[model samples]
Target chain A: MLDLALKSIMRSKTRSFLTTFGIVIGITAIVALGSVSEGLRIQISEALEMAAGLIYVYEESDQPLFLAMASSSLSEEKIQEIEDVGGIKESARFVMDIAYLDGDQQFGQPDLFINGVDPENEELLVTESAELDDGETLEGGDAYSATIGYSLAQDLDIGVGDTIELKEENFVIVGVYKKIGDPGLDNGVLIPIETALDLLDTEEYSGIIVYPEDLDDVEEITDYINENIEGVTALSTEDVAITISSVIDQIQIFTFGIAGISAIVGGLGVLNTMIMSIMERKREIGIMKAVGATNNCILQQILTESVIITFFGGLAGVILGSLGAYSLRFISSALESATVTPSLAIGSLIFAVLLGLLGGFYPAWKASKLDPIEAIRYE
Target chain B: MSKTIIEVKDVKKVYNQGKPNELVVLKDIDMKVNREEMIGVFGPSGSGKSTLLHIIGCLDRPTSGKVYIEGKDVSGLTDDELALIRGQKIGFVFQQFNLIGSLTALENVEMPMRICNVEKRKAIKRAKKLLSSVGLGERINHLPSQLSGGEMQRVSLARALANEPDIILADEPTGNLDSKTGKEIINLMEELNKKGFTFVIITHDPLIAKCASRKLNIKDGKIWR
Candidate 1:
């Protein structure tokens, strides 16, 4: 029966190929887009863990979370109050903003943002994975010194001793950080806090980073700051990671939803193909019935044919989608930080076959229910 | 002293019952076919010969009568049961030489045996022997499209004998062939009948009908034996 089904599909080469192409497109979209989204989520989670020891204290506002993180509601006094919290080991006041840099293009786009870090608290601000690739770290009270991330340095075609213009200020590149696999940190520049204030013309710091003496002290210190500090919100690193995780999950759902729509369209293509096949093979089915083929046998044959179409389509899609994901390096530089290798999971393959089965069911049932005599008489 | 292989009692068939355009295709049909008997049912088109053959072969149910195959009542059998009976006890040859286009001649012949759960080796051996016996040994590997009309009908005949069924129900087996090809098919049936294979052939062709040992003429849904 399966052999016959395969032969029938081969008999109509163009129609079968077109139907399988629909499934290919759908599975490609799902795997490629899903890999990218999953890659972003993984990178974000890793970045969060990398900064796990630090709690961020910022002003509470009605603004969006990202904008709220960028604009400081914290004053110098608020920083003092956060530092005065019990169990706090160290604190850093920094300003961060998206600033256009005048340099060579990375991934055909200008460099992302600049972070203003106090030279005194540079050690606490830079993640542990970061290492100076060239030049030297910023010294206390260094005015206009900038450290560029590894990818940014490569993108801009600049190294130590070179200068990049940020918001009309030419800052000499003092150091370059190694590739840290964090996009936000890898594509941005780090400058002196005083220079950032001088350039952005803002006196208030964007936020304060507080370190706890022990892992157990993190939540305690966050609660204490939230209680003592007025009009400011203190969040443990875990809380921040959870928020980011939820946001990533939402994005994943949206991406998968879009992919699902394409898959459904692909399923409809299967349905159409199966219906046409049944209609064309009406007499053939009648002949089979007359030769003692039970309805179940006919049903199995049709379902098997549908599954074979989708199964091959799914395999092809996985290959294509993996290629698409890998090809991201040639298309975008941002993906270099969070390069996600697409995985062809067994679940997805099963899902594809199930889609074929579902799409082929009604048509197969109709074929099985056909009256043998009438079908035999059908032209 | 041959036992009856097929017994049809007071059979009637109606299409679209309780409707204004009702069609009564078969009425008051009664017949008994003995073992190894080649009974030819002759009629023009729409004379219900095929309908009666279908009822006797358990492919269709008679609306108002009982059908007995090998002394077992099959009137109220389920579709699956009917299919089993057809698979194990009956074989069908249609006017169109309804060979599955995708399968080769050998596969077509082996289909009924396979459905009856015959072992693969045994079924293949039987199919090969049947095809060779029908003078189609060289054509077993050919698809229906590759075979000539006479060759395709020969393949169909070989397929009908695949399970060594008790009865072969052939409806206009040579209807699509020219006179020369039709003669060849009729000769094959007569030879098989001589080998003690029971047959019920429905045809309007007098030449084909003359080959049967017994004749039953059907007209306007009634049979005159």
Candidate 2:
């Protein structure tokens, strides 16, 4: 029966290919888009873990995460109060903002993600800028000396001792940090807090980083600050990661909405093609029935043909979608990066087959119900 | 002492019944076909020869009577049950040759045996033997379009014998062929009948009818001696 169905499909090569093409396009959209979304989420979740053991102390606000993090002001007195708590492993003032360099820069994108660090703090609360690949970390009482991240140095052709103009002030690049696999820290620039306050014209720090000596003290510390500090909110890194991941999930759900529409269109294409194919072969169905084929047998034959088409379409879609994901990384680096997951590809493949069964059911059933006598007589 | 292979008792068939066009194609027809007999049903178009053949072949149920095939009452069977009887006990050849054009001659012959769940290797061997017996051994791999009308009919004949059925019903098997090719099909039917294969050949051609051992005339939905 499978052989007969295959022969029948092969005889009408054009129709079979057009039907399969619909499934392929739909699956490709699902897999490629899903992979890019998944890849960006992974990169972000990994980056979010950079603050794993530290607690962020800031004034409470409902702004979006990145903006809230940069705008949460903590004065010197507030930072001192948070550091005085027990189980504390030294804390430092943290200031962060988006900055733009003056004049021409390599790659033409002069915008830089900046973190204001106070080198005077023996324990740099923000551990991301503690290590340097070239030159030294910012010196105590350093003025206008900046440490840049590895990717920024490469993009802007700046090295240690080179002067970078920020807000009309020339600052010496004292160090370039090593690649830590966190895009925010790997591509960021760190400057002394005093200079950041002077250049950006902001006297107050954005927030204070609080370090608990023990990992188990994180919950107690966060609860203490949120309850006792009145206006300040304390959040663990995990809380931030969950918030960001849910945001990514919303994006993923949006992607699925688009992929689902394409899949529905593909299903309708299969329905149209199968109905036309069955209508053309009504006489052939009659011949099979006249030769002793039961209704179940005829139904199985038609269903198997549709499944065969989708199975091959799914296979081709996987191959093409993986390549498309790879090319998408190069074509549009909108996020951190894109990586195709095996589970997502497999899911798309299964979806393709289910699409076939859904679209082929009614047509197959109708063909099976045809009367053999009248069918044989149908021209 | 021959056993009855097919018995149609007071069978009636009506098209568009109880409506304005209410045509009765087969009216209370009675027939008996014994084993290994070549019963030719001769009739012009619009007669009920084909309808009677359908009732006996288990392709259609009689509206008002009973049909027994090999002593089994098949008229009361469901469509699926009738399909089993058709697969196991009866084979049919149509006027257009009715071959599935996608399959080769050998595959066409193998169709019924496959439908009946005959073992693959054994069915292939039997299909080859049947095709060769019908003088189509060399053309087994050729599709129906590649074969001539007489060759296509011969392929259909091989297919009819594929499942080793108890009866073979040929409905105007030579209707689409020229006289020469038609004669060849008639001669093949005669030779197979002589080898103890029961046949019910329906035709309007007198020359083809002459090959059967007995002939019954049908006109305007009634059978007469």
Candidate 3:
């Protein structure tokens, strides 16, 4: 019976291919869109990872968009108070925000992330990833120098010894950080905390990253900072990842909504093709029925053909969708270098199979119920 | 007494029973066939020949009478049971040489036996032998479209004989063939019948009617000896 169905499909190659193409398009869209959420979640989780025993403290007043918004800052006295806690071993101050070059501001070009790190904690809390890929490091008192990440240097077409104007202040490029595989870090510009504060016109640091003496004290220390510090929130590494995931969950719902449209059209395509094919093979079906094929046999044959078309469609869709996801990298520049790493999704294949079965049942049933005498006489 | 293989009892067939455009194709048809009897039905077009053949072949149920095959009354059988009985006992050869176009000659011959749950290796061997018996051995791999009209009929005959059916109901078996090719098919049927296979052939050809051991003519939805 399976062989017969295969022979029938091979007998009409063009129709079979055209029918399968509909499923292919739907599965491709599903896998491609699903990969975007998967890729971003992975990158964000990786970026959230740092030295394990550290806690990040941000000025808080119920601000949910932690990555982009920071309206207030922590005064030096507050940082001292947090550092004075029992388990703290080291600390670093950061002033983070979006920034554009002087020429970019004049031309209305977009801004890259500007990350300010305390010069005294440069080696400890900062530069924990790798060595400089180009040029020299900043001197202890080189207040106007900035070190950029690898992708930033490549994107801006700037290197060591070039002077960049940050607002009204001029800073020389000191070094370029090596590629760390995290897009957020790979596209950021790192400057001294004092220079960044002067340029942004802020008098204090926006956040403080503290390291505890014992890794086991992280949760307790986080709780202490949140409870003891005034108007502040302290998040551990896992907490930050969880927070980002909740945001991504909403976006994932949106992605699935888009993929849902493709599924309906693909299923309709299967239904239309199967019905037309059955109409053409009316006499042939009657012949089979007259030759001793039961209603169940006919039903299984048609359903088998449809399932085979969609199974191969799903297989092809997975490969094509992964390639589509990989193409997202080339267009990431327009998206401020929010790079995507393509990942294959197995769930989409299962969805395609279910679609095929549900879509194929009605046509198969109609075919199985056909009266042999009438069908054999059909023109 | 010879064993009665099939009997049609007072069968009246009505089409669209309650509708304004209703048709009554077969009225009060009665028939009986003993084992190994070659019965030929003679009729013109729309004279209920095919309709009678359909009932006798178990492809359809009678509208108001009973049909018995191999001494078993089939009036109470479900569609699936009737299908099984057809698969096991009745073989059909149509005027159009109704072979599945996608299957090769050997595969077409194997279809009924496969449906009857014949084992794979045995079915293949038997199908090969049946095709060779019908002089289609050389064209066993050919599709229905690849064969000539007469050759397609030969393949159709091999297919009808696949499961060693108790009765072969041929509805104008050679109707579509040229006269010369038609002669070949008629000769083949004669040879098969001489080997003791019962056949019921419906044809307008005077030769087939004469060739049969018995003849019945149907006209205007009634049958007469």
Error of 1 at B203 (Å): 2.9
Q: Report the lDDT tens digits of candidate 3 across residue range A1-379.
A: 6677788778789988987888888888888777778767766665566445568887876658564235658888887888888898788888877666544554433456677887667644443655678876554438888887788889889888887666767788888878654554566777888888888888788888888888799999999989987877888877877887998898878887788678768888778878888888899888888888888888988888888888888878877877777786687653332323333356787777877887788899999899998898888
Q: What is the TM-score of chain B alone in each candidate?
A: 0.97, 0.97, 0.96
- lDDT score for residue B35 of model 1: 93
Give lDDT tens digits, candidate 1, residues A33-85.
77777788777777777788789889987775666787655688877877777
Error of 3 at B176 (Å): 3.0
Ranking by DockQ: 2, 3, 1
Alpha-carbon RMSD to native, per candidate:
3.4, 3.5, 4.2
For all the predictions, what are the DockQ values? 0.54, 0.66, 0.58
* Clash-forming residue pairs, model 2: none
Of all native A–B interface contacts, model 1 reproduces a fraction of: 0.41
Better of 1 and 3 by lDDT: 1
Per-residue lDDT value at A111 in model 3: 54
Minimal lDDT window, size 10, model 2 chain B: B204-213
DockQ, Cα level, model 1: 0.54
